[model samples]
Target: MGAEAILEKIRKNAEEEAAALAKQGEEKAEAAAGKIRADAEAEAAAILGNARQRAEELEKRERLMAGLQIRKNTLAARRAVMDEAFSLAGEQLADLPKERWEALITRLLLEAAETGAEIMEVPAADREKYEWTPEGNLPIIGEKSFFKRLNAALKESGREGKLTLADAPANVTGGFRLMGPVYDVDASFDALLSQAREDWEQEIYRILYPKDE
Candidate 1:
């Protein structure tokens, strides 16, 4: 073949090879771009899912916190009401008539009396208020008051005991302390009511909070 023709054929073959390589390179680049796009979409979907899950968790936590606060408030309100009820009870007892109080004192003394000798400790206020009488119907000591009658009542109630008023007063509100050589009895209103407060709490709650019913 002629040199010119041979050179032209060589140039055409070189051009075709270059074109094929260019097309292959373009196809590889496009495939790489498509893979990158798919990866980015997957990453975005994962991020979105995590954000949604976090939001749901936060909402659930907030709801739980709100519920706990509500319960705490309800308990506080209930406690306040119970405290007021107890305050009213104290007031009512303090407001009792003198006659009723004497009768109550007599009953308490009678209940506390036992065979043999016993001593009664009353509040300082009661000491100034009531008088004491020795054995048998006598003139009396201190003032004309409940303690005088108390001894007679104890004897009549079949308690074979000498009830003597203590020199020192008791630290009590409404009831007295009965002391014997064997054992002592505390009939203070604070003590007796405190012991039964737990047993009575539920009943008091039911009476005050009947909204559930």
Candidate 2:
């Protein structure tokens, strides 16, 4: 072959080899870039999904806390109202009329004195109003009295009854305490009201805190 022809053929072979290498490199780079982009898009979608789930969870937790706070506040308010009502009722009961007070005491005494053998203990504040005689009879005004009422109640229950007032006054608010040989019965207004409140707490709560419309 001639020298110029050999040199031209060598140049043409070199150029073709270089072009083929460049095309292969470009194809590899494009494939790598496409894979990288796809991975990045998938990561972004996962991150967005996680963020949404966390946001929903946080919202639900906040709602639950808010509901609990509301319920706590409502219960506190209801308790306050019931306490105030009971305090007001106590004041009214303490300030009851003399006639009503006497009637209540009489009824309590009648209920308490079952056998009439028990001693009826009265408060110092009530010593002047209700006086007991030595014969175990208490005079109301002149003839009609608590002894007759107690006797009538006991006889109706088919039991002989006898009641005498205690010389020592009780420390109580309005009601009396009946002392038998074995056990003593507390019929005081404070004690009675406390028991009543315990028994009727649910009913009282319902009345105080009705469901909202």
Candidate 3:
């Protein structure tokens, strides 16, 4: 009811109000801090996930590039092999002679008879040497002289009855083709030399490029 008592009441009410405002400010600050921390964590996780995805994509691209490079190298190697094989065959054929060719054909026929070959086919160029008949029991090639020589050689080797020349001309050069019931023998210079070169190609490459080893 007096002035001092009213002043004390006013001071007490002001103190209580100040305490309540302070508590409210602290609560708001804590809530804001929590929100900031959560936002920071989410941002960090997003950045890490993006970096991981980018790294995986880079690795996949590198692997694909490596596979492509390997396939290209393999194709190049096969092409080199084919080129060398044909080149060597051409070089060998350039210097071969008729006598050598005839002798080789004779030998192939004899060997074929021994191996149970019933029919022997030779190139048209060497047909005359074997004395082949046009329509006899033993077949003859188109060239008469090559057939004569072939027949003579077969008779000399005691394989005339078993050695029958084929009427069809061969597809190859400087070699005879022998056909049996179950197997075929190609004794042509091209085929023989090709096989020899194929067997030696790896060794030759190693010798030529020793650093590759």
Candidate 4:
């Protein structure tokens, strides 16, 4: 072959090699750019996830604090109500008259007779009103005026023979207790007041926190 023809062939081979190298460089650059973009996207996703978690935690903490505050207010209000009720009851009991006491005892005795009670006990403060005897069939103790009144009332209702009066502890207020052969009834002021509190608990809460609705 001629030297010019050989030189031309060598130049053509070099050109082809240069073209292949250029193509390889372009592919490498594109791969590197794609990897950088993927890494950036992954970092952005992590940041977004962390932000969402922090927001949720803050909301939960706020809700917990709010609940604790509400509970504290409710307890304080309930305590105030109990105090007021006890004070009012004390005032009423302190002002009770002897005639009122006797009437209350009579009513309690009639109720006990209706319930088939055989024996009754009452507060020690009301023993004097029970001196009048009924048919004298039932033994009556006048040591507790409340019990005596109960026995007298029972006797007046033809149940005197069925009921006996006993003196209870002096710690009790104006109310009386009825004890049958089988069961006993606690009709004391404390018991009645306790029932009243139970019955009015919901109403009290409503009055205290009407805005909660």
Task: Estimate the TM-score of every prediction.
Answer: 0.72, 0.67, 0.57, 0.68
Candidate 2: list runs displaced more than 4 Å: 1-28, 132-158, 167-169, 209-213
Compose the digit string of candidate 4's lDDT tens values, residues 114-171: 5444656556654444543444343454334445555556667776445655645435
**Best candidate (score: TM-score):** 1
Q: How far is candidate 2 from the true structure (C-alpha RMSD, Å)?
A: 4.9
Model 4 collision count: 4
Of 2 and 3, the candidate ranking higher by TM-score? 2
Q: Give the lowest summed-lDDT range of ten residues in model 4.
A: 131-140
lDDT by residue for model 3 over 1-213, one digit each (tens)? Answer: 999999999999999999899999899899999899999999999999999999999999899889889979976886697678667766666456767756666666777665342677777875654554544435435445565555566667765445567889888766778887777788777787778777977887677667779
| C-alpha lDDT of residue 52 in model 3 | 92
lDDT by residue (1-213, candidate 2, tens digit) is 999999999999999999999999999999999999999999999999999999999999999999999999988988888778777777777788867876787677666665667888888887656654434354442234544555556666666656667889889876889998777899987788888788987988877656741
Off by over 4 Å in 4: 1-15, 114-117, 124-149, 156-158, 167-174, 207-213
lDDT of each: 0.78, 0.76, 0.71, 0.69
Query: How many residue pairs of model 3 clash at the backbone?
Result: 21
Score candidate 1 by lDDT: 0.78
Best by lDDT: 1
- Model 3 / residue 158 / CA error / Å: 7.5
Which segments of model 3 are wrong by more than 4 Å? Answer: 1-42, 45-49, 52-60, 63-67, 70-78, 103-111, 115-117, 128-161, 188-201
The TM-score-based order of candidates, best leading, equals 1, 4, 2, 3
Better of 1 and 2 by TM-score: 1
- How many angstroms is residue 50 displaced in model 2 relative to the true structure, after the best TM-score fit? 2.8
* Deviation of model 2 at 186, angstroms: 2.6
